[model samples]
Target: MTYKYILPIDTKNVSLEMIGGKGKSLARMASSRMSVPSGFYLTTSAYKDFVQKNNLQKDILNLAKPEIIGRTVSFESASKHIQELINGVELSDEIVNEIKQAYGALNGQNPAVAVRSSANAEDLPDLSFAGQQDTYLNVRGEEALITAIRDCWASLWTPRAISYRHQMGIKQEVVAMAVVVQIMVPSDVSGILFTANPVTGERSEIIVNSSFGLGEAVVGGQVTPDSYVVDRKTFTVKESIIGPKAQKIISSDKQGTILQDVSEHERSQSSLSDKSLKELTSIALNIEQTFEGVPQDIEWAISHGKLWMLQSRPITNLPPQPIEVSWEPTPPAKILARRQIVENIPDPVCPLFEELYLTKGLETPAKGQSRKSFFVGGGPMFVTV
Candidate 1:
């Protein structure tokens, strides 16, 4: 059944404008038969309609104007006002009923789920407004889901999010929020996977951070997760650093999440086995391939030994592939030292500059001077070995 505000997780023909970045990516992955959890998207159209009905555009724009005009206005104050305007307004009954129906279809009666913000401007190759908006985990029941949805919309006006958008030059009126409602995976082990090594910018390496329980412990920095660097080609673990794994985050019986302390024995142990690491690496490689070889920042979970993809986005601000450098000088210049002329040159010299200046211009003495005279007359002689 088609709904005005909701689309199934595996819906085809979804665009970033309609479902926002997160929703679109999830839909793509789901349609591709990836092991993504069942979910639905509260489309950006829903957010727009809510705002229009509540007459919030003018007020939201006006509040955000100070930031645009370069005034010394408090972002916190403006964000608070805008968020209040959004949260205080009642969502239409039509939209609420649609959400209830979708939620029911997703996992039967009041299933525990995650409500994530998916702004239209988020998770792009250039602009990754990651963690800029809210994500409510372990949200249950129709009323709670509705409240979470509204709060997700409000999170768009968070102080950090507002400042980030202002910095990114994203217009206030142009952006809209979509919410991803996914069944909560009671992950035994969960963490993040970088299809590329984000630290050293090695495209051939995949990095994984694994921790016990829900991924929030790893993602939120509540605990230092076990780190594994795997060879992308071989799907082998190149390095592993076991973290303390002191604590883990889990969903509460009622609602929200809980941070619990791990037992002494468990704290010292590795969160993931070698087999699981290989499996994760394989999945990461597949995801990278799916996104046309673009390095991905993926969120994943393992429940009962099965892998589930929560989210995957382009790894923004990733450095270029590391260039292999030979310290030994080429040809006649066997000795390479940061001395004399080389002292001022911080970066590697280009071949053109080297040919035009170092090889020719520097080698030639002044018009009236001989080689010996050039050296003796205060002209420093460059020695190329």
Candidate 2:
């Protein structure tokens, strides 16, 4: 049988169109021999298959329209409705069989895995869609895995996601979600690494956030992670702070990972050893080089002291490097929208409307208040300031 639904993550042969951005990046790193975990990606074909099988495309598309046409619900209501629609649909036997077969290849029976969302519209160099979709870590068994995949698909139509796409001018019909399933790393220490300093845009320094148990505590902002600043060239630690990790999430046999209180003794000590910190930084630098020297925002974990790359993508919305002198910062101004709006507008704005409407100087209903409208372009999409 042809396996159009599922494809291996590490292969260099598949296209981004199939596996989506997150899957393609993982494939790229795996190709470069980076320490990426073994995984499989359920391709966009799978999402299309599910949608087509249930005749869901039309209903979802109409609901997703920014104009709020059918049933006329608020964003929250629309999100709930769309998610309910997806969750209620039955999966095809072929799709279910392929998913089970893929999981069986990973482990003999049921094994813990990470089911993550991979969307075609995310992971762009300029836009950050990292956490907009759902991710289920430490998921166990076939039934749970199936449920996670369905949830990941439902996340594609979430209110935030729908708003993001509409505002960015991405067509709802053109987008699809690919679910990524990977062996769950039994992490002793897990964290995030930024190749370039996120605060000052200094390429010479790498920022690392480390914590106990799973990295989700750090990534999800559930707890304050131990922070570190390491020099890029020398691989020397410059700064460190041990966060108050009073609790952590650890894997459980019956219910995936569970959050429990930490011992008073373990709270004061550093979550990462000096050696581990240096090593994670080194691997992060290597990842930066692997991505053609672009600054990278990487997710990482260490299982049995072996480092693994969970995900990596270009650092979106990074400021210009301090050394670069191509342009200077603009002073505070009353511009309506910035580059995101410019790039998002697919069509040209009308010349006539640009001068007359949205040019400012409007009155308000209140005695002291004046109404001002700021537009994304010369379009009807306006923001009240």
Query: Which model scores highest in lDDT?
Result: 1
| Cα shift from native, residue 313, model 1 (Å) | 0.3
For model 1, how does the per-residue alpha-carbon lDDT over 15-82 read when each residue is reduced to its tens digit?
Answer: 89999999988998899889999989999999999999889999998987444345665588798899
Best by TM-score: 1
TM-score of 2: 0.81
RMSD of each: 5.4, 13.0
Q: State the weakest 10-residue window (summed lDDT) of model 1.
A: 372-381
State each model's CA lDDT, in order.
0.86, 0.83
Return the clash pairs for model 2, or none.
none
lDDT of 2: 0.83
Q: Give the least accurate 10-residue stretch of model 2, judged by summed lDDT.
A: 325-334
The total number of steric clashes, by the backbone 3 Å criterion, in model 2 comes to 0
Error of 1 at 329 (Å): 6.3
